[model samples]
Target: MLTKRIIPCLDIKDGRTVKGVNFVDLRDAGDPVALASAYAEQGADELVFLDISATQEQRKTFASLVKEIARHINIPFTVGGGISSVEDVAPLLEAGADKVSINSSAVRNPQLINELSKAFGAQCIVLAIDARKIDNAWIVHTHGGKNSTDKKLFTWAKEGQDRGAGEILFTSMDHDGTKNGFAIDPLSKLHALLTIPVIASGGAGSMGHFADVFALAKADAALAASVFHFGEIQIPELKTFLKNHNIPVRL
Candidate 1:
């Protein structure tokens, strides 16, 4: 089996790293460049830097910060927020992002995924899906989980894969920042239905929660924000705990 990955997400807003509950009530975390570099040194498999407000604010990503953070880390970094087209990805890649994540923009134009993949490569694109449980099914949410779409989560995942998305970063809006645990039912369904990697996000409360997501959800990777940002969970220790649980992980 491929070793599962542990990734730390840096949600940037106003040029500072921030964390929030269910995608609101933002609070300062730290300097993104500093945080990214620290995570790299501490053994984070990859880093996700999301300019959380870009979509809502209707602006481009924080290129200055992206460049700064990229310069600080050697590990692969995925940058997201307001990335709308192939042109948007060029500067991000040139700025040193290994991949660019698309959320609201991709939902708005599904074809954008195909264009980006063709222009760059499937390996350079990651589809970030934020969804909420609605009427017995997971429904996709856009603009940082503020709006729900008619599209079903599973269908969207499959569509993204068909469009050549290399990976899916699945985050449950209901579970985000709750620290209760992951929404495993949806994650498991996604994992079984999609061939590409699924990165489970949200509600990772403890070391055991990490174990549960992999064992139950079958996620390729697990991502968290507050727990890691506030020092509630440390990357190396979490890897060790996963190792103890027989979850394949890089330590």
Candidate 2:
């Protein structure tokens, strides 16, 4: 069986790491490069760096910051936020990102997924979907979760897969920073629908929550921010916990 992955997410705003509840009222976490190095040293399987304000600010990801963070970690790093085209992806990859995540741009132009997958190979493309449950259906959100679109979650996942996305990073806006748990129902559904790996993001409170996402939702990976950011959970401890629960995890 493929061992599940534990990823730490760094939500960046103003060149520093930040985390917010329901995507608002952001608070500083730490310096991004320092946090990345710490997580890598803690045995985190991967790191996700999101320029949380890039799209809203109408600018590209800070390549210099990405390069700075990349130099400290020897793990796969995925970068996102305000990435709109192949041109935008080159600098980040050159800066040391193993993969690039596209969210708002992918939704605005579905072909962007295809173009990116083809340009960099599907394995290097991660489609990030920020969604929330609305009227019994999950709707996609953009612009740092400030705008909602008519697109449904599952449909977009399928479309992204068909367009050659190697993985789906699904963040439940409703459960974000709640410390409750992951959105298992939708995660399971998406897992069943996609051949690619599905990364369950948002609402990770404890070790049990990680196990639940893997056992109940069958997510290939679980990504969290605040819990891991504020020392609420440690990657080494979490891995030990998952292994004890018979969840395959890299120790």
How much is 48 displaced in model 2, in angstroms? 0.4
Local lDDT at 199 for model 1 = 96
Which residue pairs collide in model 1, if any?
none
lDDT by residue (1-251, candidate 2, tens digit) is: 78999998887876777664222222323677777777888889999988867454433336778888878888899988888999999888888889999999999999999999999999999999999999999999998799999999999999999999999999999999798999999999998999999999989999999999999999999998878766788789999999999999888
Span of ten consecutive residues with least summed lDDT in model 1: 20-29
What TM-score should be assigned to candidate 1?
Answer: 0.91
TM-scores for the candidates: 0.91, 0.91
lDDT by residue (1-251, candidate 1, tens digit) is 68999998887886777654222222323667767777787889999988766454433437767787777788888988878988789998998889999999999999999999999999989999999987798899999898889888999999999999999999999999799999899999999999999999989999999999999999999998888777788888999999999999887
Candidate 2 residue spans exceeding 4 A from truth: 19-29, 54-61
On lDDT, the leading prediction is 2
Q: In terms of TM-score, how similar is model 2 to the real structure?
A: 0.91
